[model samples]
Target: MNPGLYVFDFRFTEYFQMTIKPLLEEGKDGELIDWLKDISLLRRGQKCTNPDCQGTKPMEWKRARIVDKFHWSCPLCKKKVSIRTDSPLAEFHCSFKIILETIVAWCDGISLEEYTKENKNVKGVIAKRIYSTCTAATDWYMQTHPELTLLGGENSVVLVDTYPDGCMTTTPHNNNYTKRVLCVADTSHMPARIWAQLIDNKILDYQKLAAVVVGHIRPGSTVVASPSLYPLLHGVKGMAEVISVEALMALDPVDYQRSLKNLETIWRTTVSVCQDIQNTSNAEGEQMLRELEWRQVFPTPLSQILHDLAAHATAISS
Candidate 1:
């Protein structure tokens, strides 16, 4: 009897420093700042962002002190930039420690409100950002990825569908209505190959669906869609379409059954994950999309998610 890989894992920090550190070590601002730098997210200097230094300053790093907490000195221009000059969290005003703590809370999967109670030094918005920027980041990921420029390939299959994302609770000021979002995922690739647009409880027609998906799909792959989508995609060129169960039935029965089975598995997982989302905010749809990507890469409870977050947040030199 051997345990699986996750069973004996010790790769993640089991205790949050802010929550459990006082009992084990000194809790002070200086220590916290050192910890932030140790994670590799914050640095003492960075490449100058000055507009005038065009390509000439290939590797010129500026050194400047940030709010007296960190130093960033520019060697070429002799001007100082913020330590967080080029990372994702660069624009935010919160301290580096708060950002790390907020991210940890999010990975732990407790509501943002609860995390605040444990750490008085953090703000609600910071914790909320763990949930907030995901959608934007996801959109950013799609726009930046080369494969997403054209979504389809030799053996690609795309599954498109929309389902209710549950209704908001009744409040005196709010009406109860079920919200929906568009899910067009390329099942050909394992996890990162998906895009979502939140419709705020509204549904899209077939023509609109085809238009949106066609751009993301590649030039020469077969797309399998529902009967309702057939009319929308009939004459679309540079791609092949398999529309409806009837169309699938026309194929070899053995292959058709296998296809149906795979389709059900993928669709069910997507829906089930979306449904697990507790917050119905329009932003959460995108966050869920991003979380899906993270889960695929890390593949565990939120702690593993935190490991990746810490790595990405701290490892940038810029």
Candidate 2:
């Protein structure tokens, strides 16, 4: 238990890259299971969580009916909690292998229904598991990484825009819902960044964009925006540039088409996937978004990415 480590160790990424990735790549999920279990159980010397007996006894890790987990029985409290008590995997009451494979499959953009079909499990189980675990983990992650709480705070060239959310059907004339996003990029960073929110109105007016820009972007950064939002870019603390379709019509078509090509491609894909669920709810839309964000930022295996995002993002105990 590295209780001494309060702030996250930067080496965590390197550890995942060097250690875990090698094991998984070699198709050694068995050994990977052992390593995951060891890491989760010994994450830190967790104290007995019982109020009356918060003692420092070495808990006995009992093998349960579950495939790859331990019931850590506290000596002082004589109580049992999962070794996953303080980890992102805790929300999943299933085994580590199921959790790990689920992460890998979901990161590959397999929907809950598809995953359940492939695994031949009941739909409700997988849906509930993914929803509870991923959502809880994501919530914990955002709360912990306050630096990344709101996007565009770092020195970045933010491209501000809106697109149809596609959570519902859209008629040709009137869009149903919209998603406003700040696409932040540093030529230095390999992968550009994005932060998004569902807005009730399709239009992102000056007042709306201005209210968001002040809270999100860092002071004195450059901002390239869509024509509709071009007027509001000045309301932000950045050097603003416009990239409206009308303005693009006057410029070289190639450059104009290329500006937001990457984000547009992803947004289109998200819209398609999100609209598939029968009676899609707000939770499902956000779940898809969370998965998209996680896949974008972390290139490691699903298990490692989930852990890194959830565990080190905040301190936890059970």
Candidate 3:
């Protein structure tokens, strides 16, 4: 029987922890498949995609002589398709449970090698494919969301800082390394919106740097940045005010102390995220930053996160 698609429910966080986790721990593959189907992660009464089929009918889920264990059959044309035909698991040939656990591992920031070591059922090659697919879906999710581009609003506190990322630095002797990254943290709400751009060691264009910073921030907003950035951002259009960290510290010691703490946290977090990738190109570094930005902006529950990713993949595949 087909179950209704799950809505964005935070309660599922508890449900997953209480029920699904135990089921997985017990190695109940059949129960896990049932739960996956219940959450719409696996196809149940999905429509047949065969263009040559005679009628538009709901595909039936039945046992199949394959590794996936189940296939969707078109009752009209007898066309059998894998249960993962159109979901995020479309290209993954692994079992449903393995793919689901791989997704969970990816979302939890678990390393691919660590995941394969823990789950003996998944091979190195298969885990890599799953991880790659998850990465692509994440990129698509972040790229499609237009609201993630610009951050902060009028009368909001925006913290801007620079961090030197080692991962983005390819070569130091050749002078082709990424020098530092300018990061903006919008503290208007919880789980602040973060945006960053890598600065090349060779190019120290202040005008270009100022322009990039201005593009990410909205007008009538207070910008808290380093003293060096003051001249570059001074008298720029639409900014409510620009204050140097030193001057602000002198003006209001309490607020300035709090801002210092926030700045330190932001830098620490950025460094930690960048260090996760080892010796990457500028393009890959930027992509990682963008993904980081996306995560910071929307820190939803894992269940909803996976569902949204699956929906995006299904749309593209269809």
Candidate 4:
């Protein structure tokens, strides 16, 4: 049996022990995978590049290459391939084991030094590779996952805010510090969709922010945000209405927190499980990987926690 494939079997055991069992005991496992799978993050395999073929089967795992990544092949076309063929992992020199480890570390928020030490690789190389992979993944996730982008419809509301990051600062002028991001959080989905930027901290710059937001969110979607953001968002098209975050703060804090907490918990569970499945690169593991990717677009435990934090903050002022 392939070692990479074994990783997923181990992961299944771990997931069942840690998450599935408890959910079953609670009588919730009936739809646990369905619920979790809806939001789990995994990769989607594409069809054979051969256009003439009527079949639309995804590439399948064949064996591990000498370097240790799982190889794939299209049965219909007789084309042999590897997991990295169409992903950010493509053309990577590291083994599948190391790539999986690096992905887990990233999801778990491990430091660069820790990842380097654990893998016995140079810190700079590890950082650069992980960064490239993540940035690529982020871009791919945003594009391929329509749920993450669509924000317009009945009862849909878009939330906007900014978070401070030390790494974002470069040269400074007026404030000597750069508030390099403006973000839009769409509450249209249970987990919410987020778009971020590295930009100057000018309020007017929100026009660009609005453009990004409006493009994803349908025109006539309700928009909500802090008072400080209203002026910046004026005259943007596609908004049916704009509400102050203060209005949201008016809701019952306890209720808001409870709902937010549950949402985050589910999101966290989904992300954790998905990352674990991706770390395993074998034939058996491939199925789980596909399932996990299918669910990745849905909200997970971690996202719920973040959303709760945002919702609670908004509620406090209401």
- What do the candidate models score in CA lDDT, each in turn? 0.52, 0.50, 0.67, 0.46
- List where candidate 2 sits over 4 angstroms from the true fold: 1-34, 41-57, 62-93, 121-127, 149-157, 165-174, 177-188, 202-205, 234-237, 240-245, 253-263, 266-291, 301-304, 308-318
lDDT of 1: 0.52
Q: Top lDDT: which candidate number?
A: 3
Model 1 TM: 0.53
Q: Report the number of the highest-TM-score candidate.
A: 3
lDDT of 4 by residue, 73-103 (tens): 7878877655445443454466434544454
Candidate numbers, best TM-score first, in rank order: 3, 2, 1, 4
lDDT tens digits by residue: candidate 1, 1-318: 011211322225555533324422443555655544555445543555677763555433332344425456555666655556665566556765566556544544545566677777776666567645533443344434545435556777766555442111111221233445556667666653555555542455666767876776776767665555556665778876545544664674663465555555565544544554435566655666555544443433334333344444543332
Q: On residues 95-191, what C-alpha lDDT tens digit does candidate 3 reach at each position?
A: 6667766766666666676668888888889889877766665566777785676878797877776654322222233334344678788878576
Q: What would the TM-scores of all predictions be? A: 0.53, 0.63, 0.76, 0.45
Model 1 residue 154 distance off true place after TM-score fit, in angstroms: 0.9
Q: Which of candidates 2 and 4 is the stronger one according to TM-score?
A: 2
